[model samples]
Target: MDGQVNRVPDGGFGWVIVAAVAIINMTNQSILSVFGQLFGGELRRMNEDTFTAALITNLNSLALNFSGLFIGPAIKSFKPRNVAICGCLFVSLGLLICSMATESWHFIVGYSFFVGFGLGLISPSTFMAINSYFSSKRGRAVGVSLAGAGVGQVFMPHVVRYFLDNYDFQIAVLAMAMVSLTGIFGAMFLKPLNPPLQHNNRKHIRLLSEKDVEKCQVTPQAETVHQPSEESFSKKMLSRLVQALDLELLKDFVFWSIIVGMALVYTATINFTMIFPSFLRHSVDLNSQLVATCMSVVAFADIICRLLLPCLTDYLRIPYRVVFLLGTLGLFVARMFLAETKDLRVIIAMSVLTGMMKSATVINNNLTISSHCRSEKLAGGLGLSMMSKGLIVITVGQLLGWIRDYFDSYVICLYAQSVILFLVVIVWSPEIYYRYRRQKRTTTKSIETTIEAGVEEVAKLNA
Candidate 1:
């Protein structure tokens, strides 16, 4: 196995990993999506202000993404399976703590920090597993895995609402804790591939072989080499640390563009979803039932797109970046329509479009990064992308709220989000075009050169 080249199965057990990841995603997202339903009444009864509630939510997101800074090292040290299992335990424990909490700060400590950090671990581990297992079908596999989130979003609310209706808050939270434990079973399936999919592992083998050869050549009486100075040793250690973290990815223009574009699209789309109900009820003067219907439509549409869009794109052989760009542009158009319309039917249509476009963006977020990174560096790329997203969300997320407060309008917020999407489209559109043209020109020149060489060889044979 050490001498053999690493090759992705692209099927078989890879599909099992996909299923396991999907279940993990479903379990994690079910708990996360229903946070409001689980804790909203309790927080209100405790006399917590909306600002405090918002802070709790923001803290959760902050912890989830900021923790990415450590995930690469964690996965490298402990392996994905162990990391995922530990994450499951952390989430379960956090929920147990949340069930017993009596204060806002308690909820913050239990739910926001603990559960958020757990999710941070589980997410990237599962993602890395999927990327390791498949190559040709990666787009479809990612879509299928992330569809679990949509499934949780669509159905978990009813399940949580049932518990909230039948039992006390603590009992419902306790039930959720038990539900979280199922992810441990899923995590157990994350076995490392034999021979592994990483080139670095093969490189290490070659290095060891070279050392063996050197040992064979050296004489028994050779003097031992002196150790390096402390300063040089420290510099070497620092360089290794930087390489492990893949900090060099930050120096790449393409990588930077991908992370920034994803961060902006994610910030805009997610924040919009968060405030969509408010927009519908207050700005559109929609009734409660209609608002609920709109939300349901969005969820259904989102899940359907998640299940189908990536598969369709892969079958069509469209580049992930191109699909991502189209999604962003579609989002910009959808938001513009949504902001301009007051009709219920038009709003519903826009909601569907928003869901579909958002699904495209979500499916391709990591796909784009994986396309750019080698197998070994994938973990670092994903971690850094998450870190960037966390920073942007923490800062710009606050600004979105401020824009709403300053204008006293959700409509203005919608416009701001559209502008964000437009900016991403502007940044990426020209780059994608330029790259396509350059590749085409290179191909054309190669074909012309080959033809001229063939003609010259035939003429020499005739002579």
Candidate 2:
């Protein structure tokens, strides 16, 4: 026990890591929201159709999500702080380059490709840093860190709108690039609990003493530990790369289930935000100011719910899966009502409800996924989910655009979202129920066996 390292500090420097990651997320979300709001105006400026503009935004999202695929390797090979710094630079460079763009293709290449990749690099690193520091209050830390998006959402529209109104698009973009540079400062502080291990194919199995059993469990932290290489250069490098990708996760059914379910949840919640400003303008004929106001309402509501719901869940001892399901149900109801509402007030109310559901779901998403696997598998599971979500975005992007383009109604788009959400819930709910029942039965049998074994031991001692 003398030389053993305590795994998680649970507080102290961990909260500092949380703050730094929160700032990174806040800036990233702000940039994303600004781009979403600018889609229509930029399309008009470039003389491009809505479909083309939507494709670009979807691609941007796809890049951002897909970047997670590389994060596992990046973190393994580089320090989290170094990777984060590189990510911030990529984001800043992307935005700066986009300011010089004169064509639709330029925007796609600059904003979608560069910025999205930068985001992909930063996203996992943020959560991983938080995870390194906090174990006991991880749920709370996740909620607080992600709430940065809400904070960004609350004010970023007005800031971006002011810049768009007062200056040319190029100047506005330039200002955003300048704003993004601050993220580098945040990234600088993202020190991990310890230097993560270099990637190795060998597994670590610690033989715990009976007294230490309650204090520590088997973990994949060796994924974080680095040792001197003992193999040929090419073979060692190849093994590290393979270890970083963690491709073996593809065999997991539970992992697939969580990813598919998350894809559906994302399609219903965050994806809607990317396209909602266009919906308000096209369907309801709302002015830019009003549209921004509605978006802000959603942001404000999301912040409030995110701040409160996680704490409440902890106090009430609610299961993460149950809360996540309830959140999805709320999102479905909100979307259904949103499709039918004509009044601005009703739409705004539904937006607020949507935000609350999104917040609740986001808070629990990581927990739900991690529950399905060992601690070491968490990074791989998240990467797989991100890759799956990106693929789903590519397919769904066209459908969403077609609904708006051919149908000429945002209501249809909202309806499409509600249906997708409903179907996912229907399909996944049975799995959750069956798994719950099986776990409960297994637990009961274990208890019975333990009791019988205890009785036999007592009889032997008396004899």
* RMSD, every candidate, angstroms: 4.9, 9.1
**Which digits, one per residue and each the tens of the lDDT, describe model 2 over residues 389-430?**
888877775577568669877788888888888887887789
List residue ranges in candidate 1 displaced over 4 A: 1-6, 194-230, 456-463
> Which candidate's TM-score is highest?
1
Please give the lDDT score at residue 366 for candidate 1. 83
TM-scores of the candidates in the order shown: 0.90, 0.82
Candidate 2, TM-score vs. the true structure?
0.82
lDDT (0 to 1) per candidate = 0.85, 0.76
130, model 2: CA deviation in Å?
A: 1.0
Over the stretch 418-447, how does candidate 1's per-residue lDDT look in tens digits? 999999999999999999999899999999
Worst 10 residues of 2 by lDDT: 202-211
